[model samples]
Target: MLSRLTQRLTRGSGELREAAAAAGELGPRAVSLVPALRAALGGPDGGTTTPDLDADTAVAEALWRIGQDPGPVVAALDSVFVRAAQNPWGRWAGVRAARAAALLGPAGRPLTPRLHPLLGDPEQVPAAALALVAVADPASLDRTALAEAVLDAARREADPMGALRALEALGAGALSPAHRRSLAALADGDARVVRSGVEDRIIRGDETFRNRARALL
Candidate 1:
């Protein structure tokens, strides 16, 4: 399986990349594919998909699944994120990078500052929020401020699900009656908002974050 995925990543075709991504979705069992996934994130070929960002995100997701040590993956992704952020060319690569950084969890703690501001990014707010959830120290997180930023994202049509999931992540201590009302309002307004309620179970982004809003908000 690892060999096949690696070959597909190297081949740079959509079908090959999809096959590789399916194997990667298998999680830690696919740990050996980490090196190949890393290469695909930025290699000259790098499984360049229609947007290129798609492949970057796919490889990053696989690394997040199996990666235990933040050592190299974090640094590499930060490099790509920094470069993409400095320029306007990257579609949503920076957002995906932050998400990958979140996947690193504790090791990714150092990247919180960079990830937080992007919660406002219209292009990929949900992914940015996901990153924050994965890396927040909880004790140190400014829940009030985080809530404000995330609520703004949820209001937008682009990726409301991201904010919905982020809302589920907050604890009762962080939410006031108004905040809860705001969430309930979102729940009532859009059925797609409830999409987060269902897909949250798959651990699409993080199992720990699954169904957070559905249960909490």
Candidate 2:
């Protein structure tokens, strides 16, 4: 039964890959794959013949395509998160969660109100944190409340990704020169991936950082 399920689930790997490649060639229209791709990632009865490599690659390609349309990306993310929550241990749940969060980072819409609760779940926490940090609007995030959340998460969990994500979200706010320097120093801190993302924002002068930098100046 499991084998049948896996086989059915994975049968579309070739189509997904072809769709992804074609979408890349076709540009934003690639969003048409959102439905099929989401199902491929989340469907239970589908056979698992598709390798993890194929699924991950297809998702990555779909994300690249979605970057051209935030609305579709946001909708896709909503679906991905819903599926991930339903099957926490599903083969690609974490991957879907992470990609969904990454895609939503820039949209900054209210469609993601469930983030805090999702972050509380151990299985979904990392992806949830990434989403929160990515989508947070510093101008709107309650700093005091967010700080408390980060500090609380730090004290409660051994995984540093959660606290680091919270810190990144907080850092999106205007920082004093001193604080900016402190965060800049973290560009070389222990978490290479998080630090790399922060540094990229710093280098690109992301809108949030630009606002903060403007205030500091």
Candidate 3:
């Protein structure tokens, strides 16, 4: 199944997106597809309006889905970030790179310091927060710093969906006391409404944090 999907990833069109999605759906079984997925994410710095851009999103997301530990999958993303950091167009790819690092969880912890700067970057805050909360082990990271950043991003965001995406990525089962308190503090008029909408979706069991944001929008 992964082999078929990987072959499709080379086709330079719609197949690229479908192949990347298939790799993600296959999960750990798709780990072997890492090299091909990496190739797809290694861009020539295409514009957002291009099909290559869509493939990059799918491939960036798929790499993390394939595996989380510091292996081919994480290396693939690390390479993308390495290049993304050097190229002017890389900022556009920065969000997905941050997300891939976050999804790697404990293995991704080493990346926290590198990601810290993006926490204050207006364009990258939500993605950076999503990554930070994933590694708030309380031992390695300054939990207070992670919590404060999450709160800061959520409170400063103008869009309800953007805030919700960052929060939901923190996951229901994993939320710490500080996280709960911070989220609860978002209570008020309009903000409360957005929270309720998110809660309602939660009650109904929306699939993923990213899915919830898309459905809400």
Quick one: best TM-score, which candidate? 1
Query: Candidate 3 lDDT, tens digit per residue, 1-217?
Result: 8667867878365688788988888888888888887767645454343345446657767876766546555555555555555655666567766876777777776667667776665557777777777754545555455545655655654333445666666555445677666565554223432333567675343234334544433
- Deviation from native of the Cα of residue 147 in model 3, angstroms: 2.9
The segments of candidate 3 whose C-alpha lies over 4 angstroms from its true place after superposition are: 1-4, 11-14, 28-35, 38-57, 60-64, 67-69, 85-92, 158-185, 190-217
User: Alpha-carbon error at 152 in model 1, in Å?
Assistant: 1.7
Better of 2 and 3 by TM-score: 3
Question: Roughly what TM-score does model 3 have, to 2 decimal places?
Answer: 0.60
lDDT of 2 by residue, 1-217 (tens): 2232223333344445555545445445445555445555533333233343334444544655555555544554455444445553542454444545555556646445756666554435545555666776646555545444444443333233444554555565534455445444433333222223457663553334333433433
lDDT of every model, 2 decimals: 0.62, 0.47, 0.61
Worst 10 residues of 2 by lDDT: 187-196
Clashes per candidate (backbone, < 3 Å):
2, 11, 0
Relative to the true structure, candidate 2 has a C-alpha RMSD (angstroms) of 9.7
lDDT for position 47 in model 1: 25
> How many Å off is the CA of 139 in candidate 3?
2.7
- lDDT (Cα, 0-100) at 83 in candidate 3: 56
Cα shift from native, residue 78, model 2 (Å): 0.8
